[model samples]
Target: MQREGRRDSWEEEIKENSSAVERVLKLVEEDAVVLFSKSGCCISVAAKALLSTLGAHPTVHQLDKEKEGEEMEGALLTMLAAPPAVPAVFIGGKLVGGMEQLMSCHITGSLLPLLKEAGALWF
Candidate 1:
């Protein structure tokens, strides 16, 4: 009974993880610009600010406040292989990576084009 209980628990965890991953995938697919963030994270705040400044009305999902946040965070970490996955940005249904990648694209003048393509920016 004890061993069976452990196995059942493991199965449930796997199910939840799968659901979280699916949820994240659906969110990224449905939005032009999706930002997975945590409210109190400074880098996330900066990412939001930068996108807003660039004319992107990003679909911001605050993982820390969401009901499935922890599971979603775990799924994000596994999917992106980026530790501390909050503040992850996805544009045009593609991973735009974290702050560093965002900064790089902006510096290279590529961010605006991508945003325009994604319909996150009109200009």
Candidate 2:
């Protein structure tokens, strides 16, 4: 009975987490700007800071090194085929490389225009 209870609890936890992940994925897929980032990475931090500075509240998907299994890695690889790296930015479902590219866009004042083009900005 105790074993069955534990299994039920674990199943519930899994279901809850799966639902959360699905929700996040749905938001990412639908959003104009989404970032797949690792928390402690410098580039990730920089990318987030830039977005914040621009007043762009991008949807961030935090990838856990330990929790993201082979399937997650494969999906990321498939999604971002070239110059594979963390802090991958997606604009309108298109992969936009890493922090450096983001910074370049910001510096060139193209970021806002791109966001506007994607119909992502309210201001």
Best by lDDT: 1
Which regions of candidate 1 fall more than 4 Å away from where they truly are? 1-16
Per-residue accuracy of model 1 over 20-122 as CA lDDT, tens digit each: 9888889999989999998889999899899999889889999989899988988777656547787899999898888888899999999999999999987
TM per candidate = 0.82, 0.64
- Tell me, by TM-score, which candidate is best: 1
Q: Which lDDT tens digits does candidate 2 get at residues 1-123?
A: 986886676566445456444544565678888887766877887787887677777777677743553334345544444345477787776666677788888888889988777767878
Error in Å for residue 82 of model 2: 5.1
Estimate the overall C-alpha local distance difference test score of candidate 1.
0.86
In model 1, the clashing pairs are: none
